[model samples]
Target: MRILLTGSVVATCAFMLFTSGRTLAHDYKLGPLAINHPWSRATPGGSKTGSGYLRVANTGAEPDRLTGGSSPLAERITVHASSTDNEVARMRPVVGGLGLTPGQTVELKPGGAYHLMFEGLRAPLKANDKVPATLTFEKAGSVEVVFDVAAMGAGEGAAKHDGMAPGMHQNGPFQ
Candidate 1:
């Protein structure tokens, strides 16, 4: 009985750590699609928004589309495409969602051209924290995922979070 108790305790501890977003890495799957490295940057207090980034690959012969998703951390999540033109930052909601052709992979990263927007955050996201969210796809339906929070300024060229980690400005870099 004592040995069984110890095993249960250890298992509980590991589960807590992983679920709480303290683990080093995480991954998820929805049928033939592979969801890898879902992540987000910490937000400041009073900020109603945040951002999420990840890579999705469609290994199946059938193509898929990332429509949108939601999270308890925010009012809703939207997939968006952002770009810089002549020193100006421009972002537009992804229309018809993002397409993932067969055997194709796409990365939504900070300071990159694509990303997820978490609007109306319930509260600020602190570094090393994790946010729970979901991704809705046209083909695979929906899958629950966790966003590993980084230090608001993580990665080679992370976004800025003065307010909501918009990482966008009329001028200058999104970094």
Candidate 2:
């Protein structure tokens, strides 16, 4: 009877651990990096592209670079940065990689900043959906992360949108 009780307790503990891991899927840590709140906005219907945002904090003495990433949901994933020139917004693929300085925090967010550009999405990302991605770094190597799907038009930073028409070139890599 004691042995059976011990086995049941072990099973319950294992189940709790599994569920808790899923509940905290948005946060992760590896090496000297602490990744927080990896998330993405819900894609509109018929949209084949989406973007991901996250905050990476470097606590080590050495710097690192975010080389690339991959996701099963997208055919290609690339890191990109956005800029505006004379009221014209343009996005270019980050040539080498996004740099993370030692003791500094880097935020991949919307509205003219660093973000992950996901092209050829297999399906539209819905609210509350979780997208799994693998990020490759220069020093810290590769880590698999889950991106929490937010509502459509959700901005990670302080940017605000008032329901602008779709394809208006308002947000995203191209604006």
Candidate 3:
């Protein structure tokens, strides 16, 4: 009986690892921009919106801006900035676009300053799902990449998911 239980546990663990599409890190390049590890968290049922995160580095002499992006999963994708002021957390759309200067690196991670908001989601994103997206830039034009969906609340600096609705706050993971 003990051996059977152990085997079952092992099998469950394997299943989870297989279901989580976060085992491999992905990267992309457009012009002089290098995007690393573009990913998103799994969304709950009936969620109309979700979030995306990644790291971007500018390796050229000229500066560029991340103008916008697109994905089939959402009708519109926009960049937003999250900040805390007077103990109040707020999120707002970033006007114009996000800029990356020469030799500069910007990270769009959970609990970070910037992120991509997916609005008007057509369907729920499940674990192991890959969401194809195109990131447009002022100088880089655009590049297609796949966003590996991780478990809900599963991301770098992501807090354990507590069943909060999809949104961003200063103190917790993006729900």
Candidate 4:
């Protein structure tokens, strides 16, 4: 029984070691701002276009706005919003910044107000792959976030937190 117990302990340690790094998803920190759960959809290899998502939280006493973003992996990054009107789904550029109130949270998910449009994808993103991006905020400066690729059509139900009602595009960025 001594040998068996030793083996079990070793096995458990190995499992934890392997899985520990897996849970450490990419994160970006800037002063009192933390961007969490950065994720994106895996696109076909060599595809020049893709999308990214994440959640932003401000732990400071002042408000902030996500002005824009950039990445070496893509030609350009733009903030976009998707909406459905008369059964039509449309996307448009968010001219103003995504507003963030002190101690508030904003989620960027699929088919809703928060979206990262990658114009020039350097490499096709595959499921389980990771992508790098630099998020720019008006008050918090810029921070790097690693976006984990999510399965296609996996974020269908993530649009209700910020009043992203069904069938309609969200109205402006959160403040």
Candidate 5:
């Protein structure tokens, strides 16, 4: 009985330690940018592209924009926006950047005013995995975040529509 009790305690401790380490391993902060609910989609092998989503809350009294971002996986990164026009969803790069008014939170969600354009991916993003991203803002500077990769075709129309996160349709890189 004593051996069994000891074994149970040891097992519980081991489990707690393992879980704690996993959580700590994934915890990262990106300066003033409080990244929340970041997610992405799985991509094919050799594919040079992927997308990321997150929310940014500006706790200051000034406005800002997500000007730029970078990652070792991408050759180029840009902020974009997509919307519906004439019943057709069109994507255009949001010139300048996404605006964040004072005390207003901007969502880098799907099918809305913000999208992360990853140009060159070093490896395929697997489902249920995490991808590292570095986001830059005009006033907030740069922040690093890990995007939890969801299934492909998962992030469709998450901003305006009721469906899953469809891809976005916005204009070119910022000027």
Candidate 6:
């Protein structure tokens, strides 16, 4: 009876460990920041660039800035924002990084918003593939997270492909 009880306890513990690890794979926490659902869209063939999005919530009293990051799947990763003026869309790198206010939640989504620009992709990011990335923050330092690859052209709210004009060379140095 004693041996059976011990074996059951070990099995329970192992099960919990496996499930917890899977849960943590999609979300990451660093200091006062909680990063949720770091994800990207699958790129088409012959595309050398891709984008990533996520939500960062700052729970601390102080603010932080998302400076930059790196990924093994890309040559370089930089923070970027898209905007439109007079019906013309444009994209530019977020100079000095993106600011995260205290108690505020910043979301990097598709379309005209703050997102990650991955230049020189090693290969096309396919749907369901996980892209590992390291995000550097002003206060939180660096935290590694995996970005889940969603279907191509996925975004927040309506799934319209905004600001991504065909052959638009507005993505700063990446173009």
Candidate 1 ranges beyond 4 A from true positions: 1-25, 156-175
Better candidate number, 1 or 3, judged by lDDT: 3
Where does the lowest 10-residue lDDT sum fall in candidate 1?
Answer: 166-175
Model 4 global lDDT (CA atoms, 0 to 1): 0.71
Residue 39 lDDT (model 1): 83
What does each candidate score in C-alpha RMSD?
Answer: 10.7, 11.1, 9.2, 8.4, 9.4, 11.1
How high is the lDDT of residue 48 in model 1?
Answer: 90
Better of 3 and 4 by TM-score: 3
As for lDDT, the candidate ahead, 4 or 5, is 4
Q: If both were scored by TM-score, which would come out higher, candidate 4 or candidate 6? A: 6
TM-score of 3: 0.75
Q: Model 2 over residues 50-115: C-alpha lDDT tens digits?
A: 998887888889999987788999987788998999999899899889998988887788884788
Rank candidates, lDDT, best first: 3, 6, 1, 2, 4, 5
The window of 10 residues in a row where model 6 has the poorest summed lDDT is 166-175
Candidate 2 vs candidate 3: which has greater lDDT? Answer: 3
Error of 1 at 69 (Å): 0.6
Tens digit of per-residue lDDT, candidate 3, span 1-175: 3545588799877765663443223556687887766789999999999999987889899999987799988998899999999999899999988999999888888889999998899999898798999999988798998887889988684321222223322233221
Q: What shift in Å separates residue 159 of candidate 4 from its native position after superposition?
A: 13
Worst 10 residues of 3 by lDDT: 160-169
Give a tens-digit lDDT track for model 5, residues 57-142: 66667788887678777776787787887899876677898787766666776666667777778788888776677778887787
Give the number of the best model, judged by TM-score: 6
lDDT (10s digit) by residue, model 1, range 1-175: 3545588799877666554442223456789987766888888899997888987879799999999899988899998999999999998899989999998888899788889999999899998787888899998999998887888678734322222214332232221
Query: How many steric overlaps are in each model, in order?
Result: 0, 0, 1, 2, 17, 0
C-alpha RMSD (angstroms) for model 4: 8.4
